[model samples]
Target chain A: MERILYGDNQFFAVNHLSDSKSQALAVRFKDNEAIIRTLDHAREAGINTFMCTTHDRIAQICDIIRANPEKYKDFKIYPCMPYAHKYANAMTDLGIAGTIKQYVPGNLFGTMFKGGKAFISKDYVSIMELLIDAEMKMFKGIKTPVIFLQNVMTDLLLGLGMVDLLKGYHDYIITKYNAEPGYITMNMPKLLDTLEAAGISNPIICASINKVNFRMSGGKEIYEETLRTRKFRAIAMQVLAGGAIPPKEAIEYVSGLPNVESILFGASSKANIQNTVSTINNFDSNKV
Target chain B: MAVRVALIGAGKMGISHLSILGANSNVEVVGVCDTSKLVLGALQKYTQFPCYTNHSKMLDQAKPDAVVIAVPTKFHYDFVKDALSRNIHVFAEKPFCLHPEQSAELTALAESKNLVNQVGYHNKFVGTFQEVKRLVKEGHIGEVQHFEGEAYGPVVIKKKADTWRSDPSEGGGCLMDYASHVIDLINDILSPVKEAHGTILKTIYSSQVDDAVYSLLKLESGASGLLSVNWSDETYRKMSTSMTILGSKGKIISDANELKVFFKDQKCPQGYSKGWNVKYVTDLAGQVDFYLRGEEYSSQMDYFINTVTGESPNTINNFKSAWITDKAIATIKKSAKNQY
Candidate 1:
């Protein structure tokens, strides 16, 4: 796991802090070149991995990376699956069958047949795998050492008690994509228990781990206890807690935690990226 | 004792409610009802809760203390009425009913039965919006003179096949689906829109229904504002609802995620400064037992379930408030018809 992972939120205008800021970012990264520039800045700032959602625009990013294989040979992307809006918009544009035919990666007829079978038999796991394949299509020929299931689907499955689907995602990613499966969830304690019950040992989980307990479902103390007592790899995200905490304080808090193998953050500027990287490195060195 | 709850519709929002209800320690999901055999089969296979195709059958057998209705807006009237008449607490999804009259009737029925009724305008549960309400009420942004409520999303960027969301009769369109949220937030955070004029329901993408809604509104407090909402905005990754209120003393800008307030002088609320003060949803939002898309989603369900269990007062997001929103929607629709 990379010690620092750059997230895609800022590039995609997913500002959890201010709408105006999000609008600014949306304008700033309206072009794909701007996003590429920011990635290059992060790479120069000593970050190697980019954790991003499988938005349609990301497909273009993947194409750019594939084109410049020499420049980004060691650059890795941890692709998160089921960029939900793409499917939702597609579902509205095309019906269920149409969406499946459009996105699922295979012969059109075979994909349709599989979709039909899954629908009829209620084989949700199969459908899940098909959707995974479809979402993974964009990351083809890229270095995705770890694949993540976005929290929207992960927490939903957790709430539904559908741990089998989680396990299915885990095993399928390993066997098919040959990447370690990571679960991004708001409820880390419950997800850990579910993963344990599903026999997914030492799973990689990413969640909001901040000093303020922002978006930490079961609260900060529980997360701290789980990190101390658990065996799984943890990736601390939202360390700044939607800009509520100062960067240094936030990174210090996350770095002081046990079993946190990586810290995930997003910034659009070179200065912010360098500052965050240095802060994390400083906190980590102090801990060591 | 736990509140025995049954769910109807079992669509996207319905399943979300069912999941939250399933996780609530104060509630037990007694039955699930939906017309789709596929959805019911999946539920039956995975969950221990009983599943039924007929809502009436589910209601009769489950004998729930409360029921959640998440069907299409057009069906909300019938389903909610049935649940209310059964002396069951009801939590129905938003755009409470297709027409204001139906919403009024349901509101009356629920009130007469003394049953707990809630409409899922989940934005009210958003912490930043809640803080907006507080700041406005506490006169941090004194005397809101003008305001603007806007919501945009990429739900329908292209000319698409007709779904329930594309049909106006089914309570689709930007007016009902998107603008209603902003209207409700304006009503809750500031004041109810008393009148609307210069309304324009433009069909940018959808053939049958309006894709964007623009109007000038007058609140009950005589403060006026603008309403601009479009569902065809591809720039937004999802629905982004925001409100900007300009006042005599200060100003406020809020969205689902954050709240920003500008006070002119030192006469500001505690923990807030004279100049620009910003608060994020993470700082304002309360924790929930189970979380999905956002804390607001689970928080709304938790509030409804708590109200059903009599643990909390049925104050916020009641049917009456939703009726106010429906009336505002009707005002906009009627005003749109008179556009030049």
Candidate 2:
């Protein structure tokens, strides 16, 4: 993982702090070239990794990167899946069986046969793998060093006490995709414990870890204790607490924490990107 | 004593509720009922809670103190009626019922039985919207002049095979699935819509139902607003519901994520300034024991569970309030038909 990972939230209109800003960003990045230009800016600022959701639009981003392999040689994408809206819209347009048939990632007969058997046997693991493949279809040639399970699904499975699926996802991403599996969750303490119990030792986990405890489930103290005590690789995200905290204070707080290997953030402008990169670098150098 | 709860319909929302309920120490999930054998099989395999194919049978066998219903809108009436008749507290998903009459009947039945009843209008639990309600009530934006409520999403982007969402009888369409949320928010934030005019239920993709709904709603307070909702908008990643209120003094724009208020003078509320004030959901949202998707989902469930356990009063999101939203829907539908 890169020390600084660029997030795709701003590009996708997912501003947790303000919707108007999100709308502005949505307009700003409406064209693919604009997204490419901003990404180039991030790359210039010494950030190579893009942690993004597997939205349909990201497929176009992947196409652009694929076309310019020389320019994006060091650029990496960490895809988070499955994008809930894609499945939701697909489920609405097509029935459950039809959605599975459409996205199961194989010949119709093979997909149907496997989908039929999975449905009959209630083999959720197979279904999960199939969906992962389908989500990964867009990032075929890109360098996805890490694949993440979005919090919506990750926390759901955790809340459901389905540790086996978490374990299944971990094993499948490693064995099939040959990438380190990362879990993005709201509850870091609970997910860390669950992942450890599922035999995934020292797993890579991304979560909201900031001064304000914005979306940090199980409270901030517990998260701090977990980061200090646990062996997992922590990717501190939402460190600014959705703009509640000053960037310097947020970075300082997260950088002072234990075992946070990476910091993930999203910004639209080159100045903001450059400012954040310098802030993180300054804090890291001061810490060292 | 934990509130023994039984869940009916283990679909998307149902499963979410089940997870939240299962995590709540104040609630004990005794049974789960769904029609799909596959869903039931998976639940049976994964969770220890008893699973059933029939709701009535589950109610009889599990004998829960409360029941959470997340079936389609068409089944809401029958399922809620069944639960209420059995003298069980009910938490049904919105748009409360298929018709206002059905909702009224259920409301009366639940009230007569003194059973705690709640409709899952989860937006009310959203912090920004909750803040919007508080600001509006405090006259922060002054007397409201006009408002615009909108909800856009990519639910139906293309011509496709009919699902329960596209079927009008199943409480499909922008009116029920999408607009009901905005309408409910408008009704709660302002007042119940007493009349609607210039209604246009346009179909962009779905054949049987309207993919978009537009109308002029007259609130009971005599304040009128524009209602615009479209489900076929591919630009939105998900359903984005917002309200822009133009008041005599200033204006307020709010969505699920943030609230922006503009005041004419320095007579602003505490923590807010004159020119423009912004607040994020993180600052306003209440904490929940278990969270999924958004805090609102867990907050709403916690509210219902607390209400059911007599720990909290049944004030917000009760059946009576949801009935008003149903009535608003009925008014919008009638206005669309009487198009002049």
Candidate 3:
């Protein structure tokens, strides 16, 4: 049975998904003395789980986590990798000839890679092994759990095979490493539906809400299906959608959404952080 | 007896006070004085009260029960002193005097005359701060630990480069211009501070006076405070007052607009133990309504009239409170560049 806990039952999970990847993390990371003290302020506000894209400056992330050992003891971190990392070894084993950069753009751009071309990507197995190994090493001796968030864009191609690929890399490291596997949902509910079709059930997924990619009807169906079939843990991404939404109105809008455990946002300054913190203070699960 | 009142200096603030006093049924504004006939001309359209070009003429002709002194900061001491000398209660707008000695003189004069004296720090009567004060008094935020206020908006200087405010002769810097609100905030939350460190910046604006001010106030009860007053940025006009009170058991954070209390619920550490629930009450908007009424003038005017008619048993007919604002402004001005 899919464990679908709701309404103040699960920990609130927030991911720093500002689209700038490493540069964004470096700018917002606490130890860098950035204008916005994201990690420190969030920890002070008692956010339990934090996720971000793998930054080039992993040392700063590690230093921040290490410095505030007790303060962020319960907080979890999830690192999101680009979609291309999946095709490394599989295509090579299959005698496919191409540059590493060519295969990555295919996975990132949905129309380019599908069916045979996606399955035959030479770097798939090698990239999976690399990611699993990096994660195992990155999460070593960490008392708080580390989770790998799999993008739910291409289940027929790569995403559904993640558990098996992770296992093949480190001999059942999927279960052995005590790593949590989460998924990020595209606007298409069929992607999630395909996960169930591939016997990959109960995936924890983060959903993005934005102008260009929002299929609310599809989102609600997938959310309900996830609640019924997969783990219903959701971190609301794209809450502000690149600052297009006013902070206060965005907060009120997010708080009104269903199945939202946490909202991920970024700030440019301390004042922004303070204002955001105040806005989030408006969230009342009971009202929802 | 009619509730006679005279407005000293028929300027912007004086005009506002006169209008508010005129609106109130209990007030009868008797006279108005201004050095400029233009100011008197504007006052005449607003009120039929006798207008004088001199303070002595206005006070003598009107024999006003109370006086509203809206003159320049430097002249506050002399005008307030004159008003108190006649045993007339004084309702003076902020920065009662530029110097502590001048303020002290006014305070002594008010005290000696037993006049109903009140200085304008009208923000205390504002709705948001009133709610915060009530919450603090009710132990909603625990023991008040820290307070930080930031009032930043576009610069609003009505005069030219050679204006009195820029001359320092008229006490025109941000320390006097902006510190009035900060000082009132300090008075409301923490008792008057014994010592404070301040820094002023003349950046961004073309005027000779400081446009930005940052001050660190050491409250009598050891609560630390920071008041950052800026007049440069135009991104948004925001006036925010926040107090974070860390008590032995719980913490209360008052954003001046709303109150958030962090007390441990009896419930065990569930998944949602650390989150906050927001309550929306409409008390804050109501306070703004009360302040917009210029209720200070009405209250002070009524008290002055009541005292003059012996309707009230006791009155502040002297200058005690005027000196308090005066000294606070002087201290802030003196330490304007001293950063802590």
Candidate 4:
């Protein structure tokens, strides 16, 4: 299946989104007409299926898969869950808890998941407990996919052991339930060490690019080093801040670098998609 | 459908406007004028539009429907007044004038002309900021109480000791270049500050310009705001333009990219409760439905052109709003002298 290749996880995230702000499968299904347009554009640009959320829109995505069985059959969906109720319901009914409920302590969006896939957040209050319950339920048929996404501010928070439970919990999930997790990392050099010490391997690490605070050189160097260390399987990219980098230049800039597997780009319109596609397609690796 | 647009001043900001306007569909760069032949000559290659050293000549030949004034702050009043008197819509860059009184006159002139006018406050168009505004309006953070904004970056100085940014006489300083953004954001998100006390750090980087400024603003809605602007950072060339709004129910923190809202209901650890909460939202449809169709230049130009055509609402980036920013700058300068 060529591993159903993608440039980055955000490709999946964006595929799940209607554009950038529509709710996932649990809230509204088949409502994100724009997201379908974007995914179609991505497919035209030579990408296959990626992991994303359907939220309350899960059934709509199912319909999409049913409608175009070959096109979207390989899509990897990861729905987000913030609390116990969402997790519990996902295990059984596969729908998230309604929005008005008092989400479980440490559960961020327990109110949003109507249920389907267990999208476990590392920032949740009782991440360990939530992961344990979610994993147990997923073994019975639910899908629990965890993501570690944070920047410097959250990194400072996680460094204080706020995410330690996640570290231990990830190990337990991958080893016991065959869970495959992913992390969107900032300061790739630093986080690579953390992943190594914990013996965590299944989770893919994405190094976000920040032109000001975290330069591309540092990120690029760390990615190359990690590739050599055999600590990471793939590297996804993100922008820690917003700046106008022409899509063509940005893709050309990263595509030539060593150990870069994918990039998470945010596009506001279809023109951006065309420009970005043209840029990605224009990469000449031999020139590097 | 092309709205003829004229470029005035032909400076760095003017060049940026020209480049972006060139890519817009509804806008056509009809003419560019500047005093310096050097500036005009350099810009000619970037535009197929006519170039003239005189604004009046360019305006006469180009007969532009709109004009973008990107000259120094001192020339803003005269240039804007000239553009508006010609019945042309005006788009001027910030710190509209060197003084509040001057900006007040320009504002009045704009009103009399009744043509579309917008300031180059492009930060408001950013996706995350729009998200913040949406979240705040939706009461995602509850009742607003206090807000704080800060824009910090390393000081820009001249390698040759004669950079225009170092000249205080020409609207060159930390407050003029940067503090306006802080004040604009504060005023836009909250109401204009009713009163403020501020302090500008002088000679932190060099004796040429003040290194930083801090302001304590009192908003018209009784909300308090703390604004800080620093041009000098001992570390790297990183900017952290952040804002936090503390409301009655919860708080929303704008961490540059993400608008994190900490709700009252989410249970937190025994120690770290009621600070900041992260909810992973995966939605692309709503945002992309609007974003995926337009060119960057057209998005902004369309907004400006529609404002001029009266087909869309005229954006409120007038001189009246700029006075609030000028007042904040004055407070910082005054506090710098007192240093209490």
Query: B1-340, model 4: which lDDT tens digit per residue?
Result: 8889998965545654665565455677888888653345334532366888889878877899999988777778888888888888888887777877777777788888787777776556544455666666766666689998877764443222334556677676667877777778777776776777655455564456655677777888788878777756523223446678887777777634445667686443332256565432211001110111112222455567778767877654556667666766666566665432
Docking class of 2: medium
DockQ of each: 0.50, 0.50, 0.01, 0.02
Residue ranges of candidate 1 with Cα displaced over 4 Å: A89-102, A105-122, B338-340
Error of 1 at A64 (Å): 2.2
CA displacement after TM-score superposition, residue A225 of candidate 2 (Å): 1.6
Quote each prediction's TM-score.
0.95, 0.95, 0.48, 0.52
* Candidate 2 C-alpha lDDT tens digits along A50-105: 99999889999999999999999998999999887787677656655567666776
Sort the candidates on TM-score, descending order. 2, 1, 4, 3
Chain A agreement with the truth for model 4, given as TM-score: 0.58
Q: What CA root-mean-square deviation does each model show from the true structure?
A: 2.4, 2.3, 24.4, 23.2
Error of 3 at B324 (Å): 3.8
When summed lDDT is taken over every stretch of 10 residues in candidate 3 chain B, the lowest stretch is B286-295
| Fraction of real interface contacts that model 4 preserves | 0.01
- For residues B133-164, write the lDDT of model 3, one tens digit per residue: 66556664456677776665444323233444
Q: Which residues of candidate 2, in runs, are more than 4 Å off?
A: A92-98, A107-123, B338-340
Q: Model-by-model lDDT, in order?
A: 0.87, 0.87, 0.52, 0.55
lDDT per residue (tens digit) for residues A1-288 in model 3: 111111110111121211122234433443454412455565565544556544334435556666777865765655554322233222211111222323333343233233324232224444445444554454444542434444422221231123334334323335666655555544225445544554555544566554322223233444444444544556666556444456777677766655556566555444665677666765663473
| Candidate 4 overall lDDT versus native | 0.55
B235-287 in candidate 1: lDDT tens per residue?
78778899999999999888888778899999888989888988778778898
